[model samples]
Target: MAPKGSTFKSCSCRDETGKKLGRKCQRLNRPDGRWSSTHGRWNYQLELPPHADGTRRSPLRRAGYANQTDAEAELNQAKELLNIAANDQALARQIADLITTAVKTTKQLPSPEEVRRKVRTGQHLNITTTLGEYLPQWLQGRKTLRESSRRSYASNLKLYLIPSLGHIRIDRLRVADVDRMFEEIDELNDLITRARETCDPVLRAQVKGRRRVGAATKQRIRATLRSALKKAIREGLTEVNVASLVELPSGKAPKALVWTPERIAQWRTDLDTHIATMSARRKRLWKDTPSQGHGHNLNRIDAYVGAPRPSKVMVWTPALTKQFLERAELHRWYALYYLIAFRGLRRGEACGLRWTDVDLDVGTVTIRWQIIQIGPEIFEGQPKSDAGEATISLDTSTVTVLRTHRAKQNAERLAAGDTWHDTGLVFTDELGRSIRPNEVTDQFERLAMETGLPPIRLHDLRHGAASFLLAAGHDMKTVQETLRLSSIAIAADTYTSLLPQLARQSAEDAAAIILNAEPAR
Candidate 1:
């Protein structure tokens, strides 16, 4: 006999009308009126507790067990799960609803331990949430992320993560699925590359303004996914972070290369060739469409051939640096350029520096703030890292230049009188307003080009500072401290190639030590 209290029994025999006889089937009972064992499959039902709102709930029902033992085991498991919510009606209702949904959909019972964990943590009891559904909610709840970081996470989710893997159940996400997303990104990259290379305007237009998803960006996307899944794990939504298991190509930064005489020569030749090739292509395009005048074609070619840099990163030699600075000395923001070139201040840092942070007598400047540009807006923010906020020692020449720049700024302030906006920044416009970081960069580029030196970016001034420190025989740790880098490894990795002069001098010194050594036993 099956146990009593919301019973367990078996009945598969159907009446002639074709409806299941259910518990009323005749074979369910023996001739003596005891229950029969082999007539039909076993099933069970139990009265569920009332809902949290005190409304009635249908009794929990499950069927299709092989025998009474199987039916009793499942019934015991259900009772155990329902017992987890003892004394908490809301939790009881949640567990009952979860069981009902699981049976109706997947037919798989959630583990009792897992359910208990979700309850204890107050996580969502629903186990069927998809990543697409959860990621946006997770991102919305992240109240402390920096604006740039939040934007990155949002972009990754909208463009890559959600579009590719959103439909998969969060619990069922696997490393292979993540890997396939990156594979699709790679395929798209191939398409973009081909589209950009094609001469046809339609082909080019199809991929216009779409940059390749580089390895570093791929790494960032993975980081965003991993972070989301990590929170999910903490919330008991997932058992594993499949994103952490996938491998990716190294996203190491490109080492800074010093622009030597030979490299500059080669770069000039390459730039000339690139311009000529673009000119020829433009002419062909113009020939194909005679309605587009030659002037329009020439202007387009000029815009397209805007002096592409030879490398992603390049630094200047001491002589070149001197030439550029000498030319920049005539510019109004010469002190800004000088501070960055010598003291390793970033563009934003220089623009953001205030007179109060500078100690002319002590020759130290604290880097507590930086002007960060997000899209078109500018805002003051903390330095990139804790190390970036520390005070850096300024050279005597730099102190003198800053003093002069202060005097010039004071004069400008006097000239503006009531109109002057006293932002207190060291670098500002004639009206005493804070200088935009991009304006500083544009001025740097213009001065650099005017100096007739090989091209380098405004930020490359930081790289040049590292090279200068290395060439002057400073140790890597010293360079790290001077540059205020977060780690010595960053300094070493970026400046390992060093200036050619330093390498040559080291080579000569090593050879001399061996050549001058006397023969020994």
Candidate 2:
């Protein structure tokens, strides 16, 4: 019956003659069912025992095969796994495609979720679109900022920071971007000091120098940028403060050359002669030249002469308070200097001084308001701070200085007749207008010139005033209070220098106190 209807290829052959073979070659089963032959050796996939939950498991969890049954089972499981993987992948693609379609159809910018979805689906997004959208939302609803501070930040943003960092999406700001920005800042020479020309090209070519900002300006920018970035982080716009991380370029310290008392005394003698000679000539020439030109000429001459600041006005001394009482100058400002030195008035406080603020009868000067000029803008304003409003103690000597100055002013007032400009100010211009501190600095610079001393600024007078008290054995706390300094460190750092002669004098005072106080031992 033809082997029960089976289909098989048979080769007809004879043993040794051309005759039909009664017996054909034995049938061989072709390799099948996940089994393959390698040089007559069998190879196949493996299958593991099922999990306890009746789920099929893989024997060749990673690779290779075990036996026939195991191989068959593994082949079956792998086929199923590959099918499941394909289906899941297709579903994920479908979902992503649907999200993209919905976003595009709705005419909406993709949310962060959509961005992640697009990324997962291998899509690209514009960085600026992603990052810039978050900025305005980030700045909303923030309070606790001062008006002037806000204005400064606004100006900085409009003028500098935004112009540099705008259009660069936050995400686009990588380490490379940071490096490039720093490079740009370097390339433009946007720093505090110019670079030194060196032979080494690598260092010279490198963006090695830090970004340099002036201390006062740097302090302001740092404060503002900190607040801005803190707001950025709070609103989840940025992960870090890049500005905070970058090192600001360092600055050279101020070189101070305060004159010694001996140097000051010598310079003062020379200055007196020059000042007397100049004052006489200046009075005559003052009306003929331009006011600014005259001031400029004097300043330039003073600078060339290397004139020191006024002895009492520019350089302070331990006995400055008492010395000012003795060698009172024009307007007797030395007396005013002593008032602030002893009593802690702002130069404006001293300038704003009134015969009324100075109660010679009671030896107290009441500080209520101050007359000050920022530029040419002049007005009476509240004392710069709360500490500004306080009573200053005047010594009997200060009272006497003031009484004499007041008498002099009074005589001048009478001489001027109807033009006394009775503002009751202790210090005044020739027109009796309140004396500007700039004018004071100008006078100080001229005085310093006249004295044949190194030129010093008027604010140095404030420094000198504080230094004298510290040298005279006052505590930092007392000096701080006396200067109305916001902090003790400010009082100490600007003042406190030890003099060997002062140390010897202190030793002598101690020795004298001990030797003179005790009986013969």
Candidate 3:
């Protein structure tokens, strides 16, 4: 039912003296004292509820409705909006303010349904809330997010989304605005690249510590925006998610490449050239400033002269893996390296493994936890994903190695006595404390160097495990389960690059099968 309001005809007809007669125009009323629809426009006026502060507000007056019915229909909508607040005076004032502002600006009434939803859901009643104002609020409300996820969302909001799209009202944000943000990011990347390549130290310093925002990072930023906007939509803030509509390049992981002879030969040549260049640069620096100590110059050169890998991800051949294990046999964490090389345990998983989770009698090890390093702080958390937490079957060789490691650990515990930390982790330092994940990686790197093998990251040992599994005639599904990957597609895409011998055998087998086939008779 429509609220009490005044619906009357009004016109701009003027008297003979040229003074405009608004509602008092004589033509608005007929001789019988009824309103003449043909002579004037319809308008409605209604007094609104008092403000939250108890002060009176001006009535809502709208002009130029076609007839009385149309004017009453709109008036009913406004009343319905006000009725939504019920006995809550504060809510009534908010609805009243919303209607007044809408009519004044857009010359239209606010949608009653939309207003009711916003009020009921405790969403912001104003449509002018900018991304800048709402993104932080949305992030603050996400209390259940993991620490790493929260950090990522906060970084994307602060570093990209807020700076690019924050000022624009969320409802008014468009796809083009989001596209422009990425375009600007690309431009910034180009600038950073140019700065790094320039000889001027000032230009380089300007971009120091600022890495190029890669496609993967940009995709993550987009995901953060999309998630925030989805929450905003649920809160009735915006009707569209502009972030989802923006297309981006695929952020696929680089394929793991086996360190074959050809690539290794090229890498060795590159390393030699790199070392010579660094040697000349070092001499030039010393010649320019003899006062600087020889040790300082050598240290600086050494830092820069470390050999660069031929690819982002490189896996050792089976022979190289064996050689590395042999060299690391005397090392304290040899079992850790052996497990990662054979069982494909992630560095963090190896660091976090406990004796309780290992079952040599059953020839299986359960992955329950992992030690993660966020910045410099180490945390014990669940595995990377649900699939990452599973029981992996171990071979007899691995069981024997683990048994030896346990014996060594017991001896160390007795030697340390009360000084031992007693972390109970299967892989720990001599003092029984859980080893840092980074320390494991650093030791693997040093071991790989000592064995004089092609350089590969500790994580690449996991990749090598996948290759070995494939080479041993295990199917893709078996490899997926053994690796505890979340999906077979991920296992297929990442580890499908076969080793050289496997590829050659596959090709030869295919050709032999075709050549040996009986011809159609």
Candidate of highest TM-score: 1
Q: Estimate each model's TM-score.
A: 0.68, 0.47, 0.65
Candidate 3 residue runs with Cα over 4 Å from true position:
1-54, 58-214, 276-310, 499-501, 505-521
The alpha-carbon deviation from the true structure for residue 177 of candidate 2, after best TM-score superposition, in angstroms, is 12
User: Model 1: what TM-score?
Assistant: 0.68
Q: List the residue pairs that clash in candidate 2.
A: 45-71, 48-59, 271-450, 271-451, 307-453, 307-454, 308-453, 308-454
- lDDT of each residue in 339-385, candidate 2, tens digit only: 65455577767787776666789888887767665435455656665
Kindly report which residue stretches of model 2 are placed more than 4 angstroms away from their true locations once superposed: 1-214, 224-243, 249-258, 261-315, 318-328, 331-334, 341-344, 354-356, 368-385, 408-425, 498-521
Model 1 ranges off by over 4 Å: 1-54, 58-96, 99-213, 284-311, 411-419, 499-501, 505-521
- Winning model by lDDT: 3
* Alpha carbon lDDT of each predicted model: 0.81, 0.51, 0.81
lDDT digits (tens) for residues 8-38 of candidate 1:
5667678899998888888888899977877
The digit string of per-residue lDDT tens for model 3 on 1-521 reads 23457788889889899988999988889899988959989988888987877888888888898899998888787778888878887877788888888888788887888777666666667687899999999999998886557766777888789999999988778999999999989988887754432223445576664657887888999999999999888877877788899999987778788787778898878777766665566566556666644611333223222567666678887878999999999999999999999999988888899999999999999999888764455778777778988999999999999999999999999999999998889988879988788777767777787677878878899988999899888888888898889999989898887655467755666787999999999
